[model samples]
Target: MKLSDKAYEKFKHHLMMGDLKPGQFISQRELATMTGVPLAPVREALLRLELEGVVQIAPQRGIQIVEVSLRFIRDTYQLRMMIEKEAAAKFAGNASEAMISQLREVHRSVIARVDEVGPSDNLLKDAQGIDDSLHDTIVSSLGNELVDWLYAMNNQRIQLIRLAHGHLTLITPGTFRQVMTEHMAIIEALESHDPDAAASAIEKHLTAALHRALGL
Candidate 1:
């Protein structure tokens, strides 16, 4: 990998891990040293992170971690509801053995790491980039091309907005634990090959996530 990519990979992990707290200033020199990259490459990586809304840059003060916006919090949860509902309804009708296996695997992996602690464990967030992988896989398995294309494009914007908002992480390890039992409900629905039940589970899951984020 290129030095810039390497730096980004390293620093990105830190950003996701919350090791680099929001509103904290990050120096190019410090990042270069920490990630074992050169100054130029570290600078390049910082620019990329900045563009991704992961960090804010100042002329001489270097980069500062940014808090997520409330507007983004609303939009992201809204997007999740719109997209995941369609994904659930569509996938419910055509779910196959392979798809069920994959969904089960995601559940197991996430549950296993639920108590692992550290970076990998911090991924228990409700943010798009973090957990939407499972939801995206489910949606695509439905073989709906239009939903697939638009979801791919919009998911990034939603993820960016999600992480840009600080308090939004609460959407995950927050009270939403009660809400996440719906994933198990989804699994049961899929096991029975009941399209309506599966769609209901996913729809409720998305709806609850949205409402919780709204504090409603």
Candidate 2:
């Protein structure tokens, strides 16, 4: 990877890992040190981040990380719904039967583990992976690199918001079950080859996720 891309990835890592906080201001040199990249690469990374709305660069002031807001939450989720619902519809029509079956089995396995163990660390980690995998699969099925890129950027912001709000570690049994069940619903629709049902399920699932992200 290029130094600037490395710097960008490192910056995102720190942001998601809570080392770099939202609304915090840091000089470019500080960012360089934090990312272990030189100042020039860090500057290039900051410009990209600024364009993505991940950070703001001011004239005399340092770079400021974006703080979570209601608008941000709504906008991110809205974009997710727009992209993912279409992806779900498309995936329902084109996804192989083997892939659909595997998705169903994995979701079922996670749901069973949650029921039996009540959210152990390992189970939670598995659940998080399952959650990410399902969405990633649906989005990648769209086969549009630009859309994929935009979805990834939006997903980073969504993850950052979730991390900031304690959503990552505070998974309750009920919440986990609901999420898995929602995934199963989408999977079922996909298996049935009903594009409309798949799209509707995705929309419903994303709507619930939006409410949860807003702490509703």
Candidate 3:
């Protein structure tokens, strides 16, 4: 990848992790200082981020993070639902026994992390991690490298939304717990190896996520 792309990813990673600190101004010089890279790539990243609508470039002023809006959140969930529901359906008929077993193993690891983190720590990070595993498992089962690549690219935007919404308090007595329940339902559907059921389960899962975003 180009150095500019590398800088883009570094900044993007920190932004999506919510590590940039809210309401902070990001200058190209500051980025270079923090990342210890030179100026060119950092400037490239800033221009790209500006074009992507994540950053605002005032003519004489510096870059600021754009407001996290509901429309973007809804769009992210819509795309995730559209792509991942199809993936789940594909996996139901296409996943091998061994692949399912592998997914089960990944589930065990996730459960272990949840136990270690007490279910409330780094909620966005954990959700994204689980989403990655589930999505990758399904896409790989479909045996489509092109689809997998597309999914990865889209996942970056998803991560940004997750970070932006991380402070929205999802793990209430009513939200994340319900979301977890829906996720479990999805796993059950996949284990049953029924395409229609899997698709339904994914829709349910995505709907629950939208509820979290809606504060419902």
Candidate 4:
């Protein structure tokens, strides 16, 4: 990847991993040092993040991480539901065996690791990865570039909300397990080739996620 892209990924990782708290202010130089990138690339990364509303730049102060507000959460979840419901319905109508297998494997992997679960950063990251993969698979199946782009942007905001929430209370291992179970419900509904069932499952999951985001 390009240096600027590397800087952006690293900076985003730190932000999502709770290394940088929401509403915290830090210098560009500090971000450069933290991400092991040069000042120019860090500046480029920060500019991108600023445009995304993940952070803001000030004249005299430094970059300020954006705070997650309830409105943002509600709006984001609404967008998520709009896309995911349609995607799930489509997926149920035409999901290939390979697609079902992929989702099933993701769920199985997370469930198998339940014994090793911990409230550590790595565990959270791993869970996030599996969750993202499952959702991305469904979203990508729709073959809509615009929808995919919007979903990706909203997903980042959701991650920020999750990180902010983690600061208040640790997400237990049971929650991750429950998440995987919820994912399995969607997968099962899709595998049944019942559009109504799949859409309903997607709606329920997104609704629960909105509730969780509200808790943030």
Candidate with maximal lDDT: 2
Encode model 1's per-residue lDDT on 41-96: one tens digit a residue.
99898788777666788888878876545675666667666777666666766778
**On residues 89-203, what C-alpha lDDT tens digit does candidate 4 reach at each position?**
9989989988798778867766667555544667666777777777788888899999988888887887777777753223355466666667889999988999899989989
Which RMSD does model 3 reach against the true structure?
A: 3.8
TM-score, model 3 to reference: 0.76
Provide the TM-score for each candidate, comma-separated: 0.63, 0.95, 0.76, 0.80
Give per-model CA RMSD. 6.1, 1.5, 3.8, 3.4
**lDDT by residue for model 3 (82-145), tens:** 7788889988887787767766666666556665665665754565566666766776666678
Q: Rank the candidates by TM-score, best first.
A: 2, 4, 3, 1
Model 1 / residue 11 / CA error / Å: 0.6
Clashing residue pairs found in predicted model 3: none
Q: List candidate 2 stretches off by more than 4 Å.
A: 168-171
Query: What local lDDT does model 2 show for residue 66?
Result: 87
Model 3 Cα shift for residue 141 (angstroms):
4.0
